[model samples]
Target: MTKRVFIIAAVSLYIISAYFSFYYFSTGSISGLTQKINLPLVKYKPPVDSKGNVIIDTSAPKTEECPLSGEMLTKAHKALWEKRRPLGVMIENSIDARPQSGLTSADIIYEAVAEGGITRFLAVFYCKDSDGYVGPVRSARVYFIDMLSEYGDFPLYAHVGGANCNRTTGSGCGNGAPADALGKIAKLKWVSYNDLNHIPYPVMWRDYDRLPNRATEHTVYSTTVKLWAYAGEKRKLSNVDDEGNEWNSQFDGWKFKDDESVNPSEAGKIDFIFWQGKSDYDVTWEYDSKGNSYKRLNGGTPHLNKNNDKQIEAKNVVIVFMAESTARDNYTEGSHLLYKTTGDGEAIIFQDGKAIKGRWRKKDVFTRIKFYDTRGSEVALNRGQVFIEILPKGNTVNY
Candidate 1:
């Protein structure tokens, strides 16, 4: 075997004979001499079994991204981000509609007080793999129109027809704030999934078992499979604006991290006072360190999703304080509350078990809203589901 030596100054391997000899001399006279060196030879060794049989591993590494959380995930868990379009289902959140269905599977849940201090939720699901029931579905509110607009490119909005009501016309005046909000958005030309039944696709139905015990209005529900199927058939899956101008244009979602950058305290008890009637509006969150998430409670008891028998959990809790206004609601026959959504406001974000005081700003309907701390640093959230609580000013959010 020849000895191999690598020369650093030039691109060549010098292989001397098995026996080496060295000589040092500097008598070279310049222009006429050149040397060509060879590289060292390497032996090849193939991987084989004990029997000298070649084996090729054909299994591919499984990897995917959860669109909602934007985190890399393995294929073992049912991915909700597989669908091309995000979906928003209007789920009722009254005393009657307790033990909600399919809430644990939502990516983001928006909660706001409806007509008479009763709150409602617009649960958004981008990863739509949940096949379970989604709601005791409710009618849309005026403000819900603006809230749902904060989601995907082409979002599927499923709700019953809604408008504000007057005390005179117990059937609802049809020209109140809720309907006015609906009309404003309709001018933007948003097509939706509703309970008109027999047009486009038929997906909304009532659970008879729930209807007997509760009001007929509170029994309407839909499933993820049904919504996906209906949306696909109705040609509502495309992200294009049929009328004119792009909707939800130029949006890059919030920043997320694998884990929180700051150390979180044991802020286990959370209080979300959504209304002046604290008796009816009381809500709380208890932290579970083992899961690194918060479990929801309504008035001191556990809040559960009846469909799957699971409590609502979130990695981030964002309470945005907005200016509130009142109007004559034709639907509820009382005062209609409208929360201004398109302005800069103070917000507090709870993540990694600690509460961070921040401010949120949204200039217009199309612009992306962001939360920043007092120093104007953008607040980063843990990569998971987030609950956006639209609390009015003077409301309490203690953790």
Candidate 2:
């Protein structure tokens, strides 16, 4: 009887494996399988107000424009954001960290290669609130720090760890290392003020259940509500800092406009890779006419947000080509990298199902990067989520 039962169990397992194998081979991808398996178990609940009301109400009229992305929002939404400073979270982009949460809620997302060919995101949140978790949180890099500087004075920066100096020798990535993010944070007086490095539990926690079998490195998760609450309650930071100054008093935000009606195009896709032959990190943005937005795909699969199982979409996709170089800090594992973040560079802005060949300029690290069209006029991006891709200067962007 025991032998007969074992044989039956083995046959059952084999049949299940064979079925999935056949599906994978036919589709050339397992994303369909992932969706089928994961969607059923989803019990996600969006955040709620004190009265148990859902914070995001799509039916409400959106009149207040977001200072970060110029996306209009309801008065209720603006009230919540008005009490908090801009929050920038470091989210990893490894294959294991797929279907990242809360990306669809970010006002602006900045993507760049963190190490080797693997990319990372600096998701900026201010005007909008995420309905669910925000990360598989990751370490920081110095360039992301510079990009976040444009948000406001001492915006909330959340990360696990960052490129820092050797604690004992104090030599590896100290004051002068280009990739010494912690060093820069300290120099800017943000060590304990607004920089959240490996925040305590409840604010940021590890969830092995979100994606089973994920390595420990990809389990750290946080939410905008928690981070903002921590910032306000623990760190004494909000829309106004401890010094009684507003966060966006000096912020030079980009211009925004409503979507433009355009003729349908036969081809409306943008594809590129951060590093050569790193196909898993390749990115594609497909323009959708009805939505007037560009849907994102990573590694040839729809990049869905785990919170709502919705594909990532953006109103504007800006590609900035900059010179990339290794920091040569000589850490034992591998040298860090640096990008030309503060300067003029060739850029391509995609909106209205079309491309605008342009240039980007940032006078300094604290200055907002602005895009200019071929005619030398500042381009007004569509009013919604803006995704900025920082690619190597020589990389080709196929559209």
Candidate 3:
């Protein structure tokens, strides 16, 4: 019991294990060795709820605030986006795909029609910035996968093929296999993208200065940063839905207006038409109220944003009449429209400049859609940016 007290306790446990290994490699953080590695560091602090907002904790710490846009986000967009998934994309609304490319940084845009009546754009991008240069990119539609399963953020579709076919002659418009809609979004394994396997390199491209002025099928294009770095190197991007489903990430009711001085109900102002006339899927919007915002026209003009010339504004458009159909493209004679973004509809909701017929309500196939008004309430919008439209019922609203 005494080799000089066991060599002075093994040289004081080797100088406290070399001073906690030089204090954890000179503070590469063990938070000062949490009581010398006793280890309990839990200080999360996220819970806010009673409308103060903050509550999404995907394990909290990438600088948060983007659980679908409570804004202020960027830690590489909360660590490489796709947190609660929702990316859709597929834009290309003819008239030579006019100035399109990340549709004014979409948070929601649907438009509809496609396959001849022209219009086509699903856009969506969860809480913003998918990387940019969003596209002339187009295709894949079965009602844009029922408007990405009625907007419960069920996305990750991205496109460059559908409504017929071409990925190097795997067929033609109305092509077979799982009966189109990009081969039923590649047989429901959903995580789609159609650069026909160019992999990590070309998500889709061909702008030879707008490729000899449009039509190699609107000069194929892509770039939400090479479509999420080629769907995260082919694991094929996910926040779920290869059957796993996941994505009720909940942004909750999206109401807003505790201050844009409460607008939405001029009952009908400046315009918002949606196929009453001037086709190309009629989309109008107008309503400036000195930038209380609306803008986007297309077919009556304006609607810019080829990445930046401006124009395409919005505070909310919505519309959603619902009830169109046609379906029949087993490869050509063209025409595969459909669009019923799921159950009940009528919803008007323009905003600031006014209009609010409202009623949309979608509750199933994964929730979150509500629009209400005609007294049933809900119609709260104004927090900025939304286009939706998706018309049907004999169209013709003109405001």
Candidate 4:
């Protein structure tokens, strides 16, 4: 019996030991199992160079090496390199101007070059006010012209302030007065200010190089200067000539003629008209006022409006229209009309301190609409000029 018991215990111990060994081997807890089974172990081999130095793999698979060190050029590194290239060009190679100011001649020249790509520019500065101090103020315009002339042979004209003297008029006193041969040169080619906003490449040349016949002639005179453009049914103030003549005319029925030859050069000359008298004269002209008269000096305001807080609202649709002249009247399509609207509400048009509506239409020229909620109901306000917004009714909101 003792011999049989000993034999049974020994067999049981052997079975338990085998089971534990199999579990550990299957779970990989027992290392070198594959070796013990005569299987090969996986090994990593890095690529080598001719000198036996490890060649870091920078290829798409990302073998090795730092991207900054150029061992491997990652997508992120390439992108960063491209982004910095333009900035380098600008920093290392840029034209420099003299006597820099918030609104400096250098700034004007640089801006023209940057925008138009024109290497040359003729900045014509003129005085719009005629009273107050004189002396240096009168000569400042001439001085600027002389300074600009030193750089290149650009057509420069100066304006002399008269009762009607203003920037738009391009009229000046003495040799620079309007109707004078010089004024005509200053008013040469009616280039729209908008077109000139961005300087074109080969900046020295105009779109067509349609140089004014009068610009070639160096003459000076004075006369009643007016911008011959037409304003459709919509009436709004614009910049004035040296004589304080604003370009606010009403065209009941005007259209552009098919004849393209009528002052085709005028298109490039009248870049665009800007309003100058909407704000205080001192702020716009940057000149000091003496009693009832004003004189220009080193400073003047370029913008016409000053009250930034003021806003224009539309009670109804408001339309604005413009044309080169009454004889050449035509409606410009795709012209934008700004307004605010709600899901359900009355529209109001606001401009120049007045809330107006039903005053503009397609037949009348340019039209804009302003939505209002007269029912005292809630309305959503989406504010934007070009992009239209349609919102569900809620509470009264300001756009």
Index of the highest-lDDT prediction: 2
* lDDT (10s digit) by residue, model 4, range 1-399: 999999999999999878769866666555544434445785445465797533433353532222111122333323222211000000000122111111111111111111112111222211111111111101112112222222211222222221222355433232233212222224433123201111222221121122123231111211111111110111111233333343222212111111111222211111111122311211111111111111111113232111121111111111222111111111122111111211223333322222222222221112112223344332222111111111112312121
By TM-score, the candidates rank as 2, 1, 3, 4
Model 2, position 278, has a per-residue lDDT of: 93
lDDT of 2: 0.90
lDDT of 4 at 114: 13
CA lDDT, every model vs. true structure? 0.67, 0.90, 0.63, 0.22
Sort by lDDT, top down from the best? 2, 1, 3, 4
lDDT of 4 at 247: 22
In TM-score terms, candidate 1 sits at 0.75
TM-score for all models, in order of appearance: 0.75, 0.85, 0.30, 0.14
Runs with alpha carbons beyond 4 Å of true place in candidate 2: 1-54, 167-171
| Model 2 Cα RMSD, 1 decimal | 20.4
Model 2 TM-score is 0.85
Error of 2 at 313 (Å): 0.5
Candidate 1 wrongly placed segments (more than 4 Å): 1-62, 74-83, 152-154, 164-179, 192-202, 210-212, 236-249, 261-266, 329-332
Specify the highest-TM-score model's number. Answer: 2
Error of 4 at 286 (Å): 39
**Which scores greater on TM-score, model 2 or model 4?**
2
- By summed lDDT, the worst window of 10 consecutive residues in model 2 runs over 35-44
- lDDT for residue 31 in candidate 2, whole number 0-100: 79
- In candidate 1, position 63 carries an lDDT of 52
